[model samples]
Target: MHLGKKKAFIFIAIACVCAGVFFALKTSNNTVKISYDPNDGSSKTTTKTVYSKQGQTVQDLLKNNGYSVDKDLYYYSTSLADQASKIHNVRIVKKANGVITIGDKKIRYSSVQKTISDLLDEKNIKINKDDIVTPGTSTLLTSKIKNINVVRVTKAQVASSEDIPYQTEVVADSNVTQGSSKVEQSGQNGQKTVVSEAVYHNGVLVSEKVKSTSVKTEPVKMKVSLNPSDIAANTSSRGSTSSISSVDSSNASSTSSSQASTSTDSAGKSTAATIGDNTSKSKGVAEIKDDSKSATVKDTTQKSETSTKAPDSSNTSNNQAASSASESSNNASMTETSKKSDENSNTSEKSDSSTITKTSTVNIPFKTCNVYVSNLAKGTTQITTQGVNGEKTVTTEMTYKDGNLVSQKEISSTITKQPVTQVVAVGTKEEQTTTQSTDSNQSGTTATSASTSSSSASAPSSSSGNTQSSLSQYVSQTKNVTYNHKTENISASDFDFLCAVVSQEDNSGYEGALAVISCIMNRADSGKWGGSTAVSVVKAEGQFSAYGDGNYTKYLNGKSSAAVQAAVKDCVYGGVRNHSYYSFQAKAKTTKSVKIGGNYYQ
Candidate 1:
């Protein structure tokens, strides 16, 4: 047993020596040379010598070495880990979760995404082209990055409408009374449609703009008639004759005579002395006759001896004159003889006399005069004083012979009411010019006010506000004016030209139309190819292709389409997209260029 023990001790000694040699070789083979890069902010690198057995991972190795490493930083090379002769290169870094700030919200995330864009897409966060972003989406994520910011932006189109007031027209009528007016037609309000674009950031409105306006209905003009009554009253105050004859007559005559015949006794001898007595009575009468045509006188006599004879025509005139003197005596003798001769016959003589006279009267009228007033405006007339009429009376005497008028003579003259002249005022002042101002608000509405001052030549200092007062006093004198809802800075002609150019250039669709207009505006702003104004830019020689083809002038005469007009308005008001493309060609393809409709822009 001692011999076996001594042999066992020697063998044990050899076994112990072999075991020490194997352990030394295994320990040497397990040794690993590691170089770690923290990749934090510090530039210092770490080197470590670790002993690891086969089938051990990099994470296990680091943990065994008492080194804490983030999961994101554990990496190892397969060739270095598998080959005992090669140096092992391992790296460890500090990493953090991505912090995203979108508007007012914050989100923490840990993802394997390579870029900010990939991270946002993975989180389903959307962004618009106009939205603002910090650390752009394509930027690579690193340990230095702690936060990402996104500003949400939204664009929209808003449409609204406003009322367009109608105007009144006044017409003058001479027959109508002053201070009175009659409405011929009632006025009606018109309608206009407005389109606007609104921009919002984080649910709050930031900016708004008008895109276009369209007239939906036309206004009906109000018509009124005015007249003055003074002219009619003055015409009616101005002024305009009727005669009779009669006759009456009475007459009476008487005559008596006595005679003795002694002629026969004287011739017979002295026997005639024997006394013989005789008695006779005679009477004569005259009568006058008057008629409308002629006058005549007649005589009749009675005697004791009577003889029947016809009167001669030559003695008629003399007899008529002589009969006028003894007219009464003859009439009385004839009456007594007729009564004595024919008491039972019932006959009697008649006498007559006639006289006639005539008279007359006359009338007159009124007048008007004019007075001028220099303070009043032209086409104005006023009556200061009214007119009155006058009258005159005239009398005349007329005589008639043989029942016919023969002579006339003035007897008296009289004055009635006297005439008064009319007074009128006519205006003779020059026309005055007025200035107007318009203001606009955020609601896209406008208000206008006006002020006026008359010229120095005809108006006094007191009449400085006449034009403004007249506008208020006579509201019916207002005229219609065209207004642009989008932009007031551009003139009507320039706006119209832009619309025409856009319509002619791109009538296929609205997008292309807007693109064409943007090009024109870009040229205007560039100040190289054309003038600054929109009109000057469009009409510049050999600029727009449409103008060179003679299509621009033809389209300008007509109305533009609604889409084209809206595009023009938006561009003018800065509602369209901005571009540096100043030229376009048809069917051309090139890099860094965009194609819209049928044209290529660069």
Candidate 2:
């Protein structure tokens, strides 16, 4: 028994030695080399060869070795949780191959392309040296990146010629008759050459800056004379008129203070001449008095007469005879003077008694209209049609006393040009909202917040789905109608007409209704089809199927659903929009057409 025990011990020792050798071989075979690189601009790398046990992963190896890595860094060769079986070389680096947009194109570049510059070379997207690139050419491509914009910048010096319009100048001239005027100088358009640097983005003109401008031809100013009649024709009842007339040198010194005249009598005293019924004596009183001081002046009826004082009653008979001869000569001279004065008085009465009437033009202000647009940003406005003032003809009668303004009144006014309405497009496009939830195990607070955000987002999504369902159900029950109704932009009547059209044409709910309204709004903003208003666009002939067929009129008479009414109002006033189409048919017939609801919009 002792001999048997010795032999068994030796055999067991050898078997144990063989089992240890096999275990060492298996351990060495499962060993892996791990290299930790911070890769943060510093060339520091740590390499380690660890004996991996069965079922042990790379993540566990890192934990046991106390090697803490960045959260963004990961195993370059394989997954961290994967078994480290026969791993030759393991590295830590940031992951790549995320989606990124370059201009309008999207690409998910491979990790092999390292940088944006390298990716562009691989994709064969050539960019000019002056072209702008977002981020940087040396920037590394990774999952954190979202977009890459490449702006193609091209510049050119362009010379273009433009015509300069001439300006008109009006000059008031009394020599130009009341109704007659002449253009002193005729106007001619001039030319100018402008040198500018034009910038283009992706073959589309973006900006142009003028470097210099040279006048090819100088513009001429138009000189015109003002007509005096225009002032009288445009007279208002509250305004006055002043007559302007050219007078001869003989009457230039005459004053219009009064009609009576003063004279020195034979007694060396001043006498005031009074006007009478005698036409000959009444004309030019000063001249008649100077002609003969001793002669007796008589009225037309011979009932009144005036004679200068007898030249000093103490004079001798010879003196009296000489005085008598002088009186006869003076009387003859007075008679001739009276005839001349009578002729002048008749001419003055003819001019003073007549009234002149004139006709002129005035401007009328245009009305402004507000239109909603879905594509434009809120609070922004664009003028689609310019406001033009209208013209109207006004006639007035003016009366003047002497050579001064007396009174004026408006006679009549008629519209010559109709005022054009101003159309302004008000932006109503709402900003889109996006919900993002990110989870992280490193912080409990972050994870909790992410969960809360995710739940909050779900509520809105569910409510939106329910609302959509309700709209769909309401539209399906309604039918199209054909009738006409007049409406204005943003007015109560406009709201009614919009609702009727939406309910009649669309059976797809809010989306369909919005599409119809958008089309109408687009047409109205363009002012091309029918008119520049929502009401006019909808009621246009052959524009909508429901109008003029009696069905639309019936719908208008009845009440529209609350949902349909809300959609119409929101689109017209609140700025809700879906499609910016002007016309629609049963199906899409062109490449520019888009299908919405039951029709194609273009």
Candidate 3:
């Protein structure tokens, strides 16, 4: 029993010693090192050592050591063990509130990430290689950063096909009728494929560039055949199908045929059918030929009968009488010949003289219209639309008798083309001038204001040389100046509205803003689109978006920039000029165009 009690006492002593060692280790203090880095741009860092119990957790250690952690701030440690000794270093970082814009989404987030790359990763935002990020990925994020922008960029090649219109060509053909035309060849349109590189910003197309264009088929030109007479009329009014020389030639041919037929029957029969072909051919040629032939036959027959029945000396008187009759017949034949010759000449002359219908063109003068403009300087004029002379067709009947003009009467007159009116812009703006001169070469006036009369005082003829020298000196000393005019029709409110429209449409620089103002001014001046005045044009239905949606009010009342205001003054006061452009749009519809800012003008 004594030996068992001694062993038990030794075991109890060992247990108490082990228990004391374990409690002492658990209660012992440890030094934990902590380092904090503020992700701010200052790059500041601080280190601290804290006393902690071995069994205490990281949170318990910090709390026991009087360290406070903000809820918005995220804390981290190199080691996250429950035991204080395991955590040698602890870091505390600050988070920031930021708004991120990517694609079409705007997200508000609070994160402890120090860089843009880390923030995007934390938000699970995927980025492609071709995408663009503003405030680059390496940019540090801080509390001061309020917004971030990311552009989703994509590249692609697109192919499209279009048909090219065929051209029509006209050709003169003699085989066709005098006033007729026919199609010689059919026209065919060509096809071409265009390859373009399209660029998109956030799924919206920003630009497209043509990479290549290949022809799939060639175009064919249409050919048309027109008669010479039709071509002559179409080409010019002076040209004629049947000229005066041709008319004269036809008349001469008919006259020669008439003379030949009166002498013999050889040419008469051959040409009798073609006589009607000449418009001036007479019927006297055939009639005279018949009479001459019959008379000749009768005379020959009578002479033969007399020769066969010869009389004796008692019929000598009959012989004398026969001789006298023969002489009478000869004289009669001579008279007939002379008369025929005269008739032939007269008939030829009558054939040459015929009524001709001619058509000629006359010019009709165009009217001039003066449009008063306030923007241009006084006494200045600009031609907007050129004057064009119109044409009219006058049909006249000319009667010619004995190769002489008898009379000409107009049959009809019709206008072929309408005259284009001349449009001139006249300046009405008054200018301040120092003096007015009579010299035609001088333009504008001096900048200074004066009350000198335009006409100089009459000089004495005795001192003409001195007066001329003095006048030359006076002209040399004067300065020339120009003033811009204003439209008396446009009200103050309308002018402000016009400037506001320009500002809202374009944010580009001076020239870019000027392009917009010019387009509006051109539309107002043209008077073909909707209205003739500036305000009327703006208020026209379905024309401008700025006025329709009332967005132009944003830039009203001097809220626009200096560039926009200057552009307005330049356009309204004639400081800048635009003559061709009358229309503009966001997208270009024609190949030939001018691009300014984000709009296209043509």
Candidate 4:
């Protein structure tokens, strides 16, 4: 059987401590020595041997020695048992209280900011000014906070408000009242945010995140104004009244002349209007008989004088004068009608002026413009540009008409790069041995070439191929193995062989090693009566090493005896997995109990 360096060099480290041996001897088993003298300038010493029983630390040792462990002092040590692994010298400080601090990493909320930065600050630790804060501003006060360090930090802080645009909403306000609200869009009341990103004081964000929001705009109340034109039209039509007066002054004028006749006329025309004054009595012939009766006139004159005193018979001339008086009154009424026509004309003109003013409106040009851009990143895939290398600023971009920008943009660039991949040439050793090919840079073919590979680390590759196919089959099959198939009865040795092959120190390009492990660990627990080896390792409820704190890499690397290596080899060559791909249960435990299929001699 071929042995690979007898247990992988069985790495065990030793630390020599001669002084430690002496110190331990003095205080190994707790030892005591002390002296005190009240007398003037005199001293005494005494010694006693003791063994440490309860606590194993040096502080405990000092306290037992009657040397008060200083509360401010720190102590550190690496137990001999941890020598194989890296042994850290623990930090310790005696506290005023009974508890002592190891590294004194414990922090309180009041004394610290509950973040890595505040924790360091509380202890008076000064970091670079450019250092980034971690755990975020809102990290909880807990012992879980961890500080990641960097030499110097180049901070790029960006504070932005995503317009919380006044939470605009269109409400169908048939009857909107002031200070009232209609849930048009329910406005969600937009918010402006203060976003801060922190990097490691020296490194990138190792952990923690926080988010918060505040309302930027108060919701607008629903409201409306009465339509002015509707009110005005209604008022005018509902309240205005029209009137006309037809006064025929001629009727009153005729009434004066016909008053006496019409009152007692045989035809009874008293209520009817007169065209002219009608004769109330006929003219008497007193003038013609005046001379003949001269002798009798003396006696008759006395009689005639008495008759003339009675009443004048003809009344036409007096009536005509009365008609003239009525005409004068009619003329006064016509003057008043002319004044009213002038007043109405003025009122109509004023109303037309008012209506025209209310309807006039002019458009004000829109101050804002929009830019419809295509071929931009769809989501927040941080578009970064080198404006001033280390420090960058963000500015708002405003789109205006005529292709002009109202505001300048902050980082208006994008770059795209291809994905990364690695490659390997399979069956090359045989090709080199038989075909003798020239180097990639050479033109002529060479003599017989040997199959040799360099041990130096290869450079990171810059090539892209089909994601899985080209690289998977080339995986080195010569290395050791370490895995458990789910169920189908694969032996322990076969599994280890597969693990060994995939983990070859020399590269054979198996990009799917981790993927295979994932599949095996997550497979169904069907045929093999249980689950995969990966699941079985964690079958202890929650203590499975894969999911536990144990490091599988360390376990695999650590001290293995020669016998174990031999046993591992025995199963790989002729055991459960001869040369075929197999599937198994996902929960099958007992990896040591597994065997190769159809190949075990036992």
Candidate 5:
């Protein structure tokens, strides 16, 4: 038969030149466009373009737009024609002059409530009456060109995990395995978040980040909240009594709006001062880890890393839970072992089991979280911004071991900026360990004294995970500041009792109060109040969690009571020489952190 039709015309011209050189180099490097409609009630302009062939995705245009981008939005379907085209594409088009479009959004309705379940149960719009809506709302509507596209349905955030299962402690020549640090991996968050995303056409907030972020099954590192300079026996209970008795350069601008005569170092002990900062110059990095692995010790002493995640966190407050499983398998790898005279700076050899092995990073320097990230959906958020809406793209993730943070993550990428409403992480810093192990093959010097006793047990693995020597307990903390003396007006009544009782029940916004103001600015108020500037102005608004936002809703609607009496008449009239450190809230009863001191500053 003519030689089998010339070998089927050379296998149909090599499958049409390998499908025309893969769709002409994937349609000139991807064009991207997909969105469709047609389950019998089809309308909202009936999208369904779905282009990307030979590869095809936007996750196959969301399994052909019946939805399933994973990490959250799911509904696979048994295909009763995709559950009757997802119930006639979620119907609701009423209009006998009272306008009600639903999908493109017209709203103003009246008669027949047209089905998508009587227009989301007569416009309350909650849906879940056992979901499923098709043009069979009794299949009536004759024309409005077929409306039905108001799909607000959302649900994705159920990926949470924490295994950390790999930690060995043989190190005998007197405890040696030391180099590594990062071991971070805060994944396993189905802490679900769909605030909005049913199919936005233009504004573009369509999220679907479901890689599920794995690989922590056995990574271990869990230090614990301690850095008031590492607690030298917490100097008389983390010291500092703020008593400046004299730099009264007229009471030093009278504490720019009363944190309670908030400034006193000429002798009384307020600690630090100077708040001229127009800010700018804070490269932002609460913790990505490693600015040369800091913490050579100087932590000063304080320990309290409380992370309830907002008391189970609001509706799962950005959903963060997955960190209690630990077998502790630390392969520990940060190999520095230096003494370089300079053989071309030790060439670069050591990470090559044939590549791909990155799981150790300990940049350590955090000693500054007072647990404060208050209603901050505006600008200046680090670990990458998230003031929330009005400006979005908020992504979050956390999983540190040896340095503390076993779990806490947020995922909402695109990373928006400047419309911050609320996000306050006041203070947090925990890397406490009390290790003290020693016993290996009952040592008696064999083989060059076993490599100098494993190089002096790995040159002091920075207190080797707190070695447990003296009943090992590094830091466990709780700090409180509550200066009281007042018939009121102690600086506009102490900045309205610290903007209404301690910035609202002491924020869950997180930061652990800047590690209790860095263990009260590295301790020893030498006669009290080290280096001064009002303890460096609330330690720079307790480590600046993006200062403030949306006028914090005019300081939460009370229209910021005349900006808290112009910040207590600009801290009692120096108009706050160069804005004496800001961030003071109002509308109070008592939250606590007042200053005046012992018998009202004597």
Candidate 6:
């Protein structure tokens, strides 16, 4: 009984010690309740109870457990160890990772960066100010931002050359033959150096800007001369007239002489004349010299006896009357001859014989005759003989009726000097072609002795058979040339604008006008005052002085001369005379600017 009682006491004491140790362990350890919701949106909560010492952190507890805490996730209590004495509830949220693409490179990152800029900084990627970013640097880095694109932008200057073609100008020439043309000046291409700034995005060209342009060489205009059809026809007519004159020389001379003789005879025989004296019983014939030349008179009358028987008072009166009548008739005859001679001397034509009774000396003009010849150059004149004035003495016969002169006549004419014929040679040689041949040995070597014969012949002469044709009114010379510069194509409106500006600004000459055009083009290429286009540069406000008062507008609407157009073309295609010059004005006293055309430029 004593041994049984001792064993029971020892068991009760050991059980009491084990119960105290369990109570101490339950009070010392802490319980952490972790709650999390899956991203699947299910209304279910996951609870995790972690038992640890009061000093253990949430991060430590999560790491110790199989649950990993994402860096991008949120935890309700980050410092659980400090709050362990007060609370034990811990909440955590899962965050998604995002992809960023930067200039063909892709990267995966968490949302911890908060912003794109921060993300880039963390990745150590640099971007230029001009670079393009799909997601702005200030944008928040969230799961919604799945893609981030970065484009590298760059600028570069590119240079190249383009050719400018020359223009053609036509001029009318009457001297050139019809249906033909001549090139006075040949056309040449011009050169232009173009500088452009190119914009590149991600190593690909996106856009280009014109930086500057310069003309290396100017184009040379082509000049062509054309003849009118009418001029050619006129020249042919002149040739034919010259030929006819040569063939009809002799006939013309003979006809001229016959006309002169016939005219003289008709004048002399204009009227009939007779000479008479005062005595009734006797008729007297008198001869007079006329101014035309020599003259003679003939009278048909029988000699009659004078009255011898005397009467008383009646007879005395009759005798007195007869004596008075005879005296009056003689006086009248002499007066009439004098008047006729005066008229003949003043005028080469014969006077009325019935009214003229006297003659006088006179001078006559000599005639000119032409003789044509062939086989000589046209417009050639040879004076075979010289003409001199002739003097002539004229005689006339007169008749009196009732004591008054009634008729008169001229008998002959004498020439002191004769007229001469003029001789002229005309060209009849038509333009012809001849060919000749020459023999030459290709090698400088002697051949073996051999019999050789040669013969000479003369060509037969042939006439041109009076065939005539006109010659060209003008002569044309042609030339061809290659340009040293290149050229570029331009719109018609732009070209017209250039032409108008040049015409108004520099009407001095082609060279001066071209200088003005060059200045404007230079300004356009400079990219300073105005736009790069020609029209923009020219129309720039306050740039061209002509545009100040709307004059430039007027000029643009007006017609431009061919010369100005040609000059503008040359300048547009070619480079400026001095590429450095950008301003020009009318010539003045100042010497700061260089002179070109009539204007000064700097």
Using all chains and alpha carbons, the TM-scores for the candidates as numbered come to: 0.28, 0.33, 0.31, 0.14, 0.16, 0.30
RMSD (Cα, Å) of model 3: 30.1
- Model 3 Cα lDDT, one tens digit per residue, 477-565: 22221223233234445556786888767745455566777677677778876887667777899777778778899766444544455
Tens-digit lDDT string for candidate 5 (179-265): 111112221112222122222222212343444444524333222222222221111211112211112212222111111112111
Residue runs of model 5 more than 4 Å from their true location after superposition:
1-219, 222-236, 247-602
Question: lDDT score, residue 500, model 1?
Answer: 72
Candidate 6 lands at a TM-score of 0.30
Candidate 6 lDDT over 465-566, as tens digits, reads 211112111101111211222333465555656766776676654566667766776677777977676668877887775654445554452245434554
Give lDDT tens digits, candidate 1, residues 445-505: 7766665644332111132322211211111231221222222136445566776777667
Give the better candidate number (1 or 5) by TM-score: 1
What shift in Å separates residue 268 of candidate 6 from its native position after superposition? 66
Q: Give all candidates' CA lDDT scores.
A: 0.49, 0.51, 0.54, 0.26, 0.27, 0.48
Clashing pairs in 3: 374-485, 374-486, 375-485
Task: Count the clashes in each prediction.
Answer: 20, 8, 3, 34, 146, 36
Better of 5 and 6 by lDDT: 6
Model 6 has a clash total of: 36
The TM-score ranking, best first, is 2, 3, 6, 1, 5, 4
RMSD of each: 43.8, 30.2, 30.1, 43.4, 37.8, 36.4
**Candidate that scores best on lDDT:** 3
Cα lDDT for residue 301, model 5? 19
- Model 3 misplacement above 4 A: 1-29, 53-57, 60-72, 78-86, 96-100, 105-115, 118-125, 140-148, 163-190, 217-602
Residue-wise C-alpha lDDT for candidate 4, range 1-602, written one tens digit per residue: 23656544432211235666766675434432222221111223233443454335544544555654443332223232222112213332221111112232433232223344554555565665554344343344232333433244544343434323222222234353322222332112233654545343333332223345555655442121212321121122211222112212223211111111112222212211111112234232111122332211211110000001111333222211111112222121111111112232233211000000011111111111011111111110100110111111111112222233222111111111111111111111110011134455565544556444222111111232111111111123423333332223234433343343222211111222332332333332322414445335333343222334333332132111111222222222212112222332112223532222211111
Q: At residue 551, give the lDDT of candidate 3.
A: 83
Candidates sorted by lDDT, descending order?
3, 2, 1, 6, 5, 4
Better of 5 and 6 by TM-score: 6
- How do the residues 468-532 of candidate 2 rate in per-residue lDDT, one tens digit apiece? 11011222233431111222235445555677777666634455666787788778878888878
